[model samples]
Structure formats: structure tokens, C-alpha cells
Target: MATTRVVLITGTSSGIGLAAAVAAARAGHHVVATMRDTGRADALRAAAAEAGVAERVEVARLDVTDTASVTECLDAVLARHGRLDAVVNNAGAGYVGTVEQDGLDPVRATMEVNFFGVVDVTRAALPHLRASGGRVITVTSVGGVVGQPFNEAYCAAKFAVEGFMESLAPVAASVGVHVGVVEPGAVASEFIGNQGIDLPALLDAAGPYAPALKAYVDRTLAAFGQAQTPQEAAEPIVEALTAEHPPFRVQTSDRARAFVGTKLADLDGSVVQHLTGSWVA
Candidate 1:
């Protein structure tokens, strides 16, 4: 049997976070499932109960964008559990649109949630992680490797997370803390469901970018039609948490590996540019 661990996962109200939390608990680990709103935890609770790991799953409220909340949540976890062996930084918001069309505020909001939120949580968790020689696993996306059309802000934030984790991994390892980033491609989950985007209204206000936006949305819809389930995408995150020596980077699926591989091997960047470029054209 795998050794039991105390794991804390953020954004567990839905999607990869929810899946990872339950999967971790089911794997004989104690899971602290946190969401911004505790009231929205019914689905997660139901899943955990059905999986027979409900008692091992503790639901908490944590708004990652707030520093006080991050500190408070971690403190409560330590107080309640005495130790946190792993942390899954899976809370994120998705965005669609160009920088010029949405202006800076929307981009800033995306960074605040997707990028800064991860940074704050990771930073806050590092001390505890180092103490326990724990692991930090973050669910970034293939967008982090291959920038997608109509996802400038989202990609930028993911890219920042990739860079941040990549840089910190080595330094963190020196203190016996393992760090890894999980890259999933086209996950069929409700990340931007919270974004409240109106497709018709978005295109109506596109101005000069309407054609590209329309094409991009059409292609994205088809891609998501065959996207991996949240459970599938969440697997790699759990692996990183449980592995004795997880690598700094991990792609969740074959499609994700191939997609991220293109960007990794592209010397002049023409191949990926042409590939993603076609989706918009």
C-alpha cells in the first residue's frame, strides 16, 4: 500500500482540482479540498462520498487571490493535520480574447488569478513543504508551452507559471522539496465557466478581430469535443505528488505531449506558429 499523506488541493469545487482532490484521498492520502466558496462544494463532497473517501476529504475555503486567505488556509491545515505532505496548485481561471480588444484590466485579472495566485500559494507552501520534504504540483496547460489563439492573457499567465516553477524547482530540490508542473491539453472542464463570457456579445464587440475570434472559437469547440475528462487530466498531478522523484515537467496525455513537444523542438518557432496559426485562419 502507498504511504498515507496529507495533501491540500486548491480550486477543488470543479474540474481538475476536484478530481485531483478525490483521487488523492482515494489513494490513501488525506485531502484538504479548498475552493473560494465553500457553498459550492456539494459536487466534490458527493464524488468523495461515492468514492468512499469522504471522511478523508476535508473541505475548506481559500481564495487564492488573497494573501491573507492563503496564509490563513495553510495555517488552519497545519493546525488541523499537523503536516501537509503535498500541495496541488490547481486553481485557475481561463480567458479568451486578444489584449487589444479586452484592454489591460481583463489581462490583469487573468494574471491575478492564474499567475499570481499560483505564485502566492506556492511561496506560502514552500516552507511547510521543505519541512516535510513534500512536493509542489501545479496543473498548468499545453497553452503554457504552445500559445493558443484568443488566449493571450491565459497563455501569458500559464507561461509565467511554467517559468516560475521551472526556475524554482532546482532551488527547491536543494531543500528536499520536489516541484513539478503538469501540462494538460484541451481538458473538458468548466474553468472559464466562471468567466461568464457571452459568445455572441464577445464577437459583436470584436471590432477588427471578429473573423479570427470566430474561427478560433469554432476550432476550440471541436478540440474540446474530444478533450480529456477532468479525471484523466488529474492523474498526472496525483502521480507527481506520489512519485519519489517527479520531474520538473509532466504532460498529461499523448496529445498534450505531442502538442507541447512541437513547441519544445521548434528552433525557429515556425512549425508551431503555422500549426496554431491555422486554427485562427
Candidate 2:
């Protein structure tokens, strides 16, 4: 039997975070599933109970954007469980639109949640992780490697996370902590819907870039149609948490691997630029 790990996951209100939390619990791990607002945990709670692992899963409040909340959540976990065996940084926000259209504020906000949030949670969990030889798994995106068009802010944040984890993985290994990143392609989640972008309004406002924006939107919709469900995407994350020696990077599906592989195999920036530039043309 696999050892029971004390695992903490953020953004468990829905989607991948919720699925990961439940999957970990079903796998015999003690899961602390946290979200910014505990009131929204109904779905997660219901799922856990249905999975028959409800008792092993605890719902908590953790606002990754707030340092105090991150510290307090980790402290409570330690006090309650005495040790933390793993942490899954799954909380993230999405932003869509060209850089010029989205403005700096939106970029900063995306970074605050998608990038800085991971930094805060990881920072707070590292000491305990080091002590227990624990694992750190983060849900990044294929955009982190490929830089999708119209996702400037969101992609930038994911790219930052990829770089941060890649840089820290080796050093963390020295201290007996494992760090891994799970990259998903087009995930069927509320991330896009929650971006709060009004498609009709944004397209009408495009003016000079309307044709390009329309084409990009059409292509994105087609891709999302083939996207993996939250549970399907969460499998790799659960594996990362339980595997004896998980890889530093893992793509959730064959499509994700193919998309990210294009960037990895590119010797020059030419390939990526050509691909992304097509969206604006």
C-alpha cells in the first residue's frame, strides 16, 4: 500500500483543485483542501463524501494572494497534522486579450494570483517539506512553455512559475524535497469563464484588430472543445504527489506534450514567434 501522506492543496473550491484534493484523499492521503472562501466548498465537500474519503479531507480557508492567510493556513495544518508531506499549488486565475488591450493592471493582477500566489504558498511550505522530504506539485499550463496568443498576462505568470520551479528543483532535491510541475493544455474549467471577459463587447471594441481577434477566438473555442475534464487533468498531479521520484516537468496529456514539445524542440525563437504571430495576422 502507498504511504498515507499529509497533503495540502489550494484553490479547492472547484475544477482541478477540487479534483486533486478528492483524488489524494481517495488514494489514502490526508488532504487539506483550501480556498479563498470556505463557503464555496460545497461541491468539494460533496465530491469527497461521495468518494467515501470525506473524513480524510479537511476544508480550510487560504487566500494565496494574502501573506497572512498563507502563513496561517500552513501553521494550522502543521498544528493539526504535525507534519506536511506534500503541497499542491493549484490556485490560479486566468486573463485573456492582447497585452495592449488588457493593460498593466490586469497583468499585475494575474501575476499576483498565478505567480506570486505560488511563491507565497511554496515559501510557507518549504520548511515543512524539507523536514519531511515532501513533494511540491504545481499546476502550470502549456502556455507556460508555448506562450499562446491573447494570453499574455496568464502565460507570463505561468512561464514565471515554470522558471521558478525549474531553478529550485535541483536545489530543493539537495534538501530532500521533490518539486514538479503539471502542464495541461486546454482544460475544461471555469478559468476561461471566470476571466470575466465579455466576448461580444471585447470583439466590438477590437476595432483595427477585430478580424485577428475573431480568428483567435474561433480557434480557441475549437481547442477548448477537445479539452480534458478536470478529473482527467488531475491524474498527473496525483501521480506527482505519490510517485517515489516524479519528474521535474509533466504534461497532462499527449496534446499538451505535443504543444509544449514544439517550444522545447525549437532551437531559435523563430518557430514560436511564427506560430503565435499567426493569431494576430
Candidate 3:
């Protein structure tokens, strides 16, 4: 933020991504906000305009799941900006179901978007980031630390992302690139609300998992009711970007910190099982 670096962020169509892009722009940085569909960029563009940071924000098309798309966006960013300071890997999707009911197909699909997508974007952006001695800030979830019921695929992908970044952070630091992960708890966004689920149909087809799934759904919905706004969640991301020496891992809120802390100290694993088990009870 002090130097006004050129920052590139993915998945800026809505929610935290949009808020992050706008917030970064408002901080006097050049923000290239990329999303899968540029047609859905009205909200981000409008927010930039409203914040009076429209000139600092540029919207681009990027599909993180596609290697070519990732390559093209990075290439374009360099060709236009001449240097890349930071990359925020925020593009991702969510899935809600157990492996037995969803099969391997949804699991693989979710991994493509949530896990491999982050890898693709980060891989493409690293060389440019290295040249500028920049940073890589990824938006992972608390699920990355603590597994939950009825979210096997989603948790697995986030866990993979966390592992990947944790392994890469030190190696990246050796070359002047700083890497950090932001873990957010429940965020009250369309991404949380619009999971494309049909409750009655899914429950009716759930077989023995129906009652547990129903309980999980009820608890999840209630928790999301108190979810933080996208703006509040985006604050940590900006902190990771601008802090003099950003921590490797940052939680968006105290609740998120405690949630991940529970996993960190669960040496026997019993504590986690006992805690998450009650979600489906």
C-alpha cells in the first residue's frame, strides 16, 4: 500500500473478491480484477465507481480452472502493467454433500476449481511476482483447517490448498516472494447462500445420510445468519498485502482464529471429532 503496487486479483464478480478488488484500488494500488465472466462485473465496476477508485481498477476475464486462461491473464497483466506486485488467489467454488451420495465426480470437479485453480493461477503469476519481489496472498477457508460434516469434497480441496501454500511459502520467501493465506469463517455472500442445492430433493435421495444431512444443513444455515460481511472479510487480505511483515497465516475474525486454533491443538484428534460430530447430531 505504501508503494502503490500493481495487484492482480481473481474472482471479482461478487462477494469477497469484489470487495477486495475495490478495497485494494481504494488503497491507491493498480488493481486488475479478473473474473470468469466479465458480464457479471457490474457490481465490482459500480463499487469502484462509487468509491471513486474506478481509474485504479481494471476488469479482465480469467478462468482459473483453465490453464490457458490463467496463462493468458498473467501474460496480459505483465504486458500491460510491466510489473506485478501481488497476486490474490480468491477464485473458488463450494460443494455440500458427502462422498457416498456425490460420488467421485463432484469431488474431482470441486478440486478442479477450489484446489487446482489456485495452483494454476499462482504458478502462472509466480515468475512475474518474483521479478517484482511481490507477494502471493490466497483466500483459503477455516474448513482448510477443520473438516466438517457433509462438506467432504469442499474441505478436502481447501485442505489441499492450505498444504500447498504452507509448503510453498518458505521456498517462495527464499526468492523475495512473500506468501500468505487468509482464512475466513462464514461470509454472508451469495457464495454462501446460493449453493445450488435443492434441500427436499437432496434429502429424499440421501438414504441413511438424510437425517445427518438435515441437521448439518440447519446448523450451517444458522451459523451463516451471523456471517461477516464481505467487506469485513476482505480487510485481512489487504492487511496481508500491505503489512510491513505479514504473518504467514491470518484469520479474518476472532471466531475464525479460534476455529482454526481448535484444529492446531487437537493432538489426539478426539477433540475435533467430538466437536464436529455434534454438528450432525
Candidate 4:
């Protein structure tokens, strides 16, 4: 029998985080599922029990935005498991607003939760991960590559996270810790419905943008229908976390790969168009 790996996953209260925790437990990994509120983690515990992997999973409180929580959780995990195999920084939220209309406050708030929050958790887990030669898997998005319309704030945050993770990849590898990023396209997670639209108030208070902002936001929201389920997009996350040698970036779902391909093509076209009068059609 194979030895069970110890994995600490954030944002396990619901959606992709929840699904990933369940899947990890089923795969014989001892999963530490961390959510902001333990009271809301009943579903996670229930799911683990239903999968008959309850004993392999533990629900804990870990608010990514809180540095103390990250430290506490990592310490608890190390104290209990003695070895850390992987850390999944999956806690994040999407923001719906244009760059100008939302103002810097909204963008900063988004960064605090999505980018800095991941940093906090990863840094806390690094010691344990390095000791065990473990892996760090960050759940980024397709928006991290190309700027999305309505979610410019969210996109900016994800873009920063992508940059940070890319830069840390070699650093982690040097310490025998592998860093992997899962760029999921539009996963049908509860993120959209749970997103805070109240940022518009801050935008109003900060000032306003041109009428074009509304058009941009509307165009972006229309793309939400293309999202796949969290389960579908997370399969690669599980695979990457467990693989002996994982790729730096794993594009989850067909839409994720398609989005990346389109972005590459667009970049190439722009370069060709700049050099020649005719567009690369």
C-alpha cells in the first residue's frame, strides 16, 4: 500500500476548494481542509464521510487574509502530521468592476485577499514543504493571463499572483519544493454569485469613469456562461499536486488551454501587425 500524503488546502468551505479536498481525501491523501469559518465546514466533513475518507480529512479554520491564521494552521498541520506533502492556496474571490470605475481601493482589496493572501499561506507552509520536499499549488485563473472586462480588479490581483508564483518557482525548487500553478478558465464555482458587487459604491465615492466602462463590464459578464464545473477544472490540480515532477503551469479544462492559445495567437498577431501593414489573419 502506498503511504498517504499530507495536503493542506485553503478555502475548503465550498466550491473548487471543497471539491479538491474531497478528491484529495479519496486519493488516500490526508487532507487538512481549511476554511474561514469552521461552522460552515459541515458540508466538507459530510462529503468526506460520504466518500468514506472522513478519517483521512480534517476540517480546520484558516482565513487566508489573516496571517496569524495561516501561521496557526501550518503549525497545527506540522504538529499533527510531522510531514507536509503539498499546500494548495485555493482561497480567493472574484471582483466585478472595471479598472477605472472600481478605483484603487477595490483593486487593493482584491489583491489583499487573492494575491497577498496566497503569499501569506505559501510562506507559512514553505518551511514544512521545504523540509519534506513538498509541492505548492496555486489556483490562478485564465484572467491571470489576459485582462478580463468586468473583472479588471480581480484580473489584476490574479496577474500579480501569477507573477509572484512564477518568480518563486525557481526559488522553491532550489529548496526542493516544487511550485505549480493551475490556471483554470471559468470554473462553474460559486465565486460569481458570491462576488462583492458593492465595489461600485467605492468607485462612486472615488470618482467615475467614461461610459465605456459599462460596455466593458457588460461584455465581460456575458462570458460567464462559458465556465465549466469546479470538479472538471480541478482534476489537473490534484494530478499536479501528486505528480513526482509537476509542470510549472497546468491549464485546467479545455477552455483554459483554449484561452491561453488564443492569447498567444493574439500576441503574435500584434507583433506581426506592428512590423507589417497587413494584419496576421
Candidate 5:
């Protein structure tokens, strides 16, 4: 039997976070399944009970963007569990549109959650992680490593996260805290559902680049129309956390792996430029 570990997973209300929580509970870990609203976590709590790990699982409220919530939750967890063995900073969302169409504010919001949110949560949990020699796992995306059409803002946040984790890995390692990232292709999550921003409003407000913005908007919608499911996407994440020594980053889906691989091998940014327009350069 795998040794029991206590894990804290953010964004457990849906998608990969939910799956990771369930998986960890089944693996004999004491799972703290967190969502922004604990009242809405009924399904997750029920699922844990059904999986027979209810006794080992606790549902907590957390909002990664709010530093106070993160600090309070971590404090509560430490008060109860004494130490946290692992932290899965999976609380994030997505937005799809041209940078021009979306403007800086929308991109900033994406960064607030997908990038800074992860940074906030991880920073709050680091002291406990260091104490336990725990691992920090983040569910970034293939987009994090490589740019995609119409996804510049979302991709930018992921890219920032990827870079942040890479830098943090060596720093954390010195203190016995291992940092790893799970880069999945597309998960069947509400991330895309929430990504539906008012493109027309954005375009009308864009003034200068309306035509180009429309083209980018159309492309953004088309690309996400071909995303993978959350369960299938969560496999690589499971592998990363369960391994004796997880790689710094693991590409979950084949499409994600292949897509990212091509970008790395080609070295020609033209393909991405073609998809994302001249802004990619």
C-alpha cells in the first residue's frame, strides 16, 4: 500500500482538480478538497464518500486570488493535519480572444487567476511544504509552454506559470520541496465555459483593430471546439504526483505532447504566428 499523505487541492469544484482530489483520496491520502464555495462542493464531498475515503477527506473553502483566504485555509489545515504533504494549485480559468480584442484588462484577469493565483497559493503553502518536504503541483497547459491562436492572454498566463514554476523548482529543491507541473492538452472543464467573454463588445470597443480582432475571435472559438476530456487529461497529472520522482513537467494528453513537441523541434515561430497573427512575434 502506498504510504498515506495529506494533500491540499484547490479548485475541486470541477475538472482536473476534482479528478485529482478523488484520485488522491483513493490512493490513501488525507485529501483536503477545496473550492471557492464549500456549499457548492456537495458533489465532490459525495464522490469522496462513495469512493470510501470520506473519513480521510475534508472539504474547505478557498479562493486562490484572495490571499487572506489562502492564508486562512492553510492555517486551518495545519491546525488540523499538523503538516501538508502536497499542494495541487489547480485553481484557474481560461479566456479566449485576440490580445487586441481582449485588451490588457482581460489578460490581466487571466493572469490574476491562472498565473498570480497559483503563485499566491503556492507561496502561502510553501512554508508547510518545506517543513514536510512536500511537492508543489500545478496544472498548467500545453499553451503554457507554447502559444496558440486566439489564446494569447490565456497562453500568456500559462507561460508565466510555467516560467515561475521552473524558477521555483531549484529554489524549492534546496529546501526539499519538489516542484512539478502538469501540462494537459484540453480538459473537459468549465474553464472554457467561463471563457465566454463578450467578444462583440470587445471588438466594438477595440476601435482600431476590429477586423483583425474578429478574425482572431473566430479562430479562438474554433480551436477550443476541439479540446479533450478532463479524465483523459488528468492521467499525466496522476502519473506526475505518484512517481517516486516526478519530472519537472509532464504533458498529459497526446495532442498536447505532440503539439508542444512540434513547436520545440520546429523552432520556426511562423506556424504559431500564422495562427495567432503578427502579435506572436
Candidate 6:
């Protein structure tokens, strides 16, 4: 029988976080499923009830952007569970716009939730995780490796996370703590819709980049049509949490693997630039 570990996951109000929380509970782990607003956790609650894991899943409020909230949530989980086992850093935000259009504030905002959020949560959990020899799994994106057109800010954040995790994994392993990242491709979820991007407005404001932006949108949407579901995307996360020796990185789908592979195979950045440039041109 698998040991019942205590797991904390962020952004459980919807999408991948919610799915991973429910799935982790179903696997006999005590799950602390957190969202920025617990008031919006109806869907997560319903899903837990349906999965018959309601008793094992506890919902908490954790706004990763706030350092205090990150500490508070981690402290609460430790107080309740007596020990921390694993943390899934799944909370993230997306931004879509050319570098010039995004400006500094939006770029910083993207980094706050997607990159710094992970850093804060991981830092808060590290001591406990070290004590338990636990795991740290973060949900990054395929864009982390391959910069997509008009997704500069989002990709930059994810790229930062991937680099951070890759560097931390070895140091973490030395302390008997495991760290890894799950990179998912275009998953069919509210992630895109929740980015708060006003597509029509953005297009109207794009000016010189309008045509390329439209093409990127069309291509991205078409790819999303064949993307994995939230549940499917959560599988790799679960595996990362439970596997005896989880991989340092796991791409959730073959498409994600292929997307990331392109960058990995490129030696002088010429091929990647050619391909990515085509998206905007």
C-alpha cells in the first residue's frame, strides 16, 4: 500500500489545480487545496464530494502573490497535518501581448504569480519538506522552453521557473528532497479565459502587430482544439508527486514534448528563431 502523504496544492479554485487536488486525494493523500479566494471553491468542493475524497481534502485560502499568505498557508498545513510531505506549485497567470504592448507592469505582474509565487511557496515549504524528505512539483508550460509569439511575458515567467527548478533539483536531492516541474502544452481549460486578456481590445490596440497577433491567436486556438484536458494534464503532476524517483521534468503530453524538443534540439538558436518568427510574420 502507498503511504498517505500530506500534500499542499495552490490555485485549486479551478482548472489544473482543482483537478490535481481531487486526484491527489483520490490517491489516498491528505490534500490541502488552496485558492486565492476560498469563496470561489464550489467547483472544487463538488468535485471532491463526487470523488468521495471530501474528508481527505481540506480547502484553504492562499494568495501566492502575498508572502504573508504563503507563510500562513504553509504554517496552517503543518499545524493540521503534523508533517508536510509534498507541495504542488500550480498557481499561475498568463499574459499575451507583444513586448512593447505589455509594458513593464504587466510583465512584472506575470512574473509575480508565475515565477515569484513559486519561489515564495517553495521557500516557505522547504524546511518542512527537508524534514520529511518530500517533493516539490511545479506546473510550468511548454512555452518555458520555446518562446511563443505574443507570449513573451508568460514565457519569460515560465522560463524563469524552469531554470529555477532545474537548478534547485540537484541541491534539493542532496537533502533527500525532490524537486521537479511538469510542463503542459495547450490544455483545454479556463486558463486562457482567466488570463483577463481582452482579445478584441488587445487587437484594436496592437497597431503594427495586429495582423501577426491575429494569426497567432488563430493558430493557438486551433492547437488548443486538440489539447489535453485538465484531468489529463494533472496526471503528470500526480506521477511527479508519487513516483519513487520522479523525473526532473515531465511534459504532460506528446505535443508538449515535441514543442519543448524543438528548442532543445536547436544549437545556435537559428532554427528556433526561424520557427517562432514565422508565428508573428
* Top of the candidates by lDDT: 3
Clashes of each: 0, 0, 0, 0, 1, 0
Ranking by TM-score: 3, 1, 6, 2, 5, 4
What's model 3's TM-score?
0.98
lDDT tens per residue, model 1, 183-202:
99988889757778999999
- State TM-scores per candidate: 0.97, 0.96, 0.98, 0.87, 0.87, 0.97
Instruction: Report the candidate with higher lDDT, 5 versus 6.
Output: 6
Q: Which stretches of candidate 3 lie over 4 Å from their true place?
A: 1-4
Give stretches of model 2 more than 4 Å off. Answer: 1-3
For model 6, residues 107-193, the per-residue Cα lDDT tens digits are: 999999999999999999999999999999999999889888888899999999999999999999999999999999999999999
Task: Score residue 104 of candidate 3 by CA lDDT.
Answer: 100
Per-residue lDDT tens digits for candidate 2, residues 12-81, read 9988999999999998899999999999999999999999999999999999999999999999998987
Scanning candidate 2 in windows of ten residues, the lowest lDDT window is 1-10
Candidate lDDT values, in order: 0.91, 0.91, 0.93, 0.81, 0.81, 0.91
lDDT of 5 by residue, 137-217 (tens): 999988897786667788899999999999999999999999999888756677766556676776787666667667766
Error of 5 at 148 (Å): 2.1
lDDT of 5 at 223: 59
Better of 2 and 5 by TM-score: 2
Evaluate residue 147 in candidate 2 and report its C-alpha lDDT on the 0 to 100 scale.
81
